[model samples]
Target: MTAIILAGGKSRRMGFNKAFLPYGDKTFIEHQIARLNKIFDEIILSANDARLYAHLNLPIVSDILPERGPLSGICAGLIRSTSFHSFVIACDMPFIHEKIILYLREQIGGYDVVVPQTSRGLEPLHAFYSRNCIQPMYRCLNEGRLRIIDFFSEVKVKIVDEQEFKELDVPTQPLVNLNTPEEYQKYCDYKAPNQRES
Candidate 1:
């Protein structure tokens, strides 16, 4: 199956693209793509700017409907992907474990959307989407309904429970995102001590 990464975040909080943040020896997106490429057949990057993820030499795509946030990116990926099910992840999510991703992929069959449910809510970005979403998504876009999870009712959504996510040591991070300089620095310090690369 294919994996589509949403890299169009405005990053108003971090003052830069989250994907560019250093993690271990590479940028977070580099780490993410490298890991994802191991399991997925093809990797598609959906972003407005081509400069980002350009060096990776993977297929890159822009939102079919720009400035519409992740929902728009997902729609574009659904249309572009050849696989019946496509895995999607947000660029800001730095700690998404491959184990959870593998589990989610296994649970994708027969569902329009396969997402994890945290104590807070659904982690839509770290999810799987079926091609069946194209029309409903198009309708949602045309109708100006831009929220990513707004169409959950229109499709068969499988909410992967805590049991599955725990294999990734998830509850500790379920969705670790860096929204500020301090938090980014902390992650950098943890991942790369003594200024040494992992």
Candidate 2:
């Protein structure tokens, strides 16, 4: 299966591009690639700013329907993926667990999407999508329904429950994503203590 890193968000809430934010020793994009590369051989990036990500040395595809949000990005990635199923995630999630990724991949068969459902809601960006979703996604985009999960009823979706996610991502860290400056700072500060101890 391929791994699709959705990096084309406007970052309006963040006030700056979170994709460039520092994660460990590398930038956020680099950090993601290094980890995702371990599980999937084909890793593609879905972003509008192709030049900004050219240095990453992976196939970068712009959204098929630009500015339409993550739904469009997911559609584009699914179309470009060589595999039947692709693991799609946003760029700002720095704490994505590898074990969770493998678990999702293992659950892909017999469903068009394998998504984690927490008490909060469905984590669409952090889920697995089958190429079978392409037509339904495009239909949703054409109908101007941009919500990521708007087309769920049209497809076979397997919802991995909160307990399953918590087992792999202990304490259920809420899929920490850097959407605002405060959240980014909090992530950095949280990592500081562990980095120093290491």
Candidate 3:
């Protein structure tokens, strides 16, 4: 399976690139690369400007349908993926656990998508996608339906709920992503005490 990282967001709320934000000893994107490296042999970065992440040395793919939000990025990543299935995630979600990734992979059988449902609703970015999703995704994009979940009805979706997460001992913190400076600061503050203890 391939791992796709979406890093093309304008980050208007963050005021800067969230991928470069510091997270412990590494930046957010760097940490995600490190974690995903352990599971996937092929990883694709979905970004608008390939030049910005050229230094990372991974296969970078720009949105085929530019500026169409993450749905476009996901479509582009799926098109470029060497594997039949790819794990798609946003750049700011640094806390994604490897175990949860493995768990999601296990659940992808017979389903075009295996997304998690938190109290906050469906986490499309933190989900698994099979090549089967490509067509519906394109349909959504061409119709200007930019919402990630807009095409879910066209695919076989397996939603892993919070109850299932608890039964598997999977921590939901992995779903947490930094979107604002205040959230980033809180992450840093939370990590400081743990870093000191280590």
Candidate 4:
């Protein structure tokens, strides 16, 4: 399977590129790539500007529909993906564990999408997408239906609820994403002590 990182967001609330934000010893994107490399053979970066991530030496794909939001990025990734199924995640989510990812991978059989639903609701970015969803997603983008879940009804969506997550000892931390400076700072502060101890 392949891994797709969505990094094309405007990051208006962050006031800077969230992908470049420091998580521990590495930048957010770098950390994600390092972790994903251990699980996936191929990793595709979905960004608006390929030049920004050219140094990473991965396949950086720009949105085919341009600025249509994450749904557009997912479309681009799925189009470029060599695998039948791909694990998609936003760049700002730093706590996504390998166990959670492996669990999602196991649930992908005969499903177009295997998404997790936490107390916060459906985590579209942190989900698995199949090649079968390509057309429905493209149709959504072409029709200006930018919401990620707009095409869910047209596909075989297997929603992994919180109970399922608990069975695997998975917590909501994996779905916690930093969208604002305050959230970023809070995470940094939370990790500072752990960093020093290490």
Candidate 5:
């Protein structure tokens, strides 16, 4: 199966483009695209400008609807993916666990979406989405409810509880979002110097 990396956020909170932030020697998008490449048969990128992800040498698709938030990105992936289901991840989450991701995909065979439930809430960004979500997302868009949570009622969702996520070799901070300059700095500091050295 393929995976979609959503790299089209406006980055209003970070005060700069989120994709360009350096994880080490490479940009944040580069780090994520590289990681996803190691697992999925195809790593698709959904961004405002398709050329931005061309450096990764994979399929890069433009957002189906610009500035409409994540639903547009998911819509774009749903339309472009060759697989019935595609795993999706937000570009800002630097600590994504590959083990948990594989586990989630295993549970996606009979479900349209495979989401993980953490203490904070359901992680829609790190979930699996099916083609069935396309129309409901359009309906949500037309109704002015662009939030990812808006279409949960329209598809089969397998919420992997916290215990399931614990099987990951390393415990992951499911929602360590780097949406601000301060948060970015902390993440940069926390990552061991040689870790993201490209």
Candidate 6:
């Protein structure tokens, strides 16, 4: 399976490029790639700012429909992916759990989207989306229905519940996203001092 990292967000809330922010031992983007590399050989980054990620040396895709939010990035990645399904994760979610991702991949037997639903609500960014969803996703984007979940009714969705998420995320901090400076600082302080670059 291919892993698609959505790194194109404007980061209005975070006030800077959250993708390049330092995490545990690397940038947030690098951390995600390190974790996903263990499972997927092909990883793609979806972003409009191709120059920013050029050094990563991976396939970088710009949204086919510009300024359409995460849905646009999803559509672009799904279209570019060679696999039947691609695991999608946002750049700011530093606490994404590999076990949860592996579990979600195992559950993608016959669904167009396999997303986890916590008390935090539906997590489409950290979900598996099949290329089969390209058409519906485009329809939603073109119709100005930018909400990722808005197109779910037209496709098969497997919702992983909060209990399942908790069981898989051993650190119990999966899906923790840094959308603000305070959240970013807290995450930075939470990492161990010994967590140096490998």
Flag the better candidate by TM-score, 1 or 6: 6
RMSD of each: 3.2, 2.5, 2.4, 2.4, 2.4, 2.3
Model 4 weakest 10-residue run by lDDT: 189-198
Query: Against the true structure, candidate 4 has what lDDT?
Result: 0.88
Where is the poorest 10-residue window by lDDT in model 5?
A: 189-198
Off by over 4 Å in 1: 167-174, 189-198
Number of colliding residue pairs in each model: 0, 0, 0, 0, 0, 0
Residues 1-96, candidate 3, lDDT per residue (tens digit)? 799999999999999999999887888899889889889989999998889999999999999798799999999999999999899999989886
lDDT string, candidate 1, 105-187, tens digits: 88877898998887767888888999888888878888889998888889999998766655655443535667788888766
Tell me the spans in candidate 5 whose CA falls farther than 4 Å from its real position. 191-198
Model 6: how far is 164 from its true place, Å?
A: 1.3
Query: 121-182, model 6: which lDDT tens digit per residue?
Result: 98888899998889999999999999999899999999988687556535545667789999
Residue 146 in candidate 2, Cα distance off native in Å: 0.6
- Model 2 ranges off by over 4 Å: 169-171, 190-198
- lDDT agreement with native, every candidate: 0.80, 0.84, 0.88, 0.88, 0.80, 0.86
> Per-residue lDDT for 12-37 in model 4, tens only?
99999999998778898998898898
Could you tell which candidate, 2 or 3, scores higher by TM-score?
3
Candidate 4 residue 5 C-alpha distance from true site, Å: 0.2
Candidate 6's TM-score reads 0.93
**Model 6 lDDT, residue 27, Cα:** 93
Error of model 4, residue 35, in angstroms = 0.6
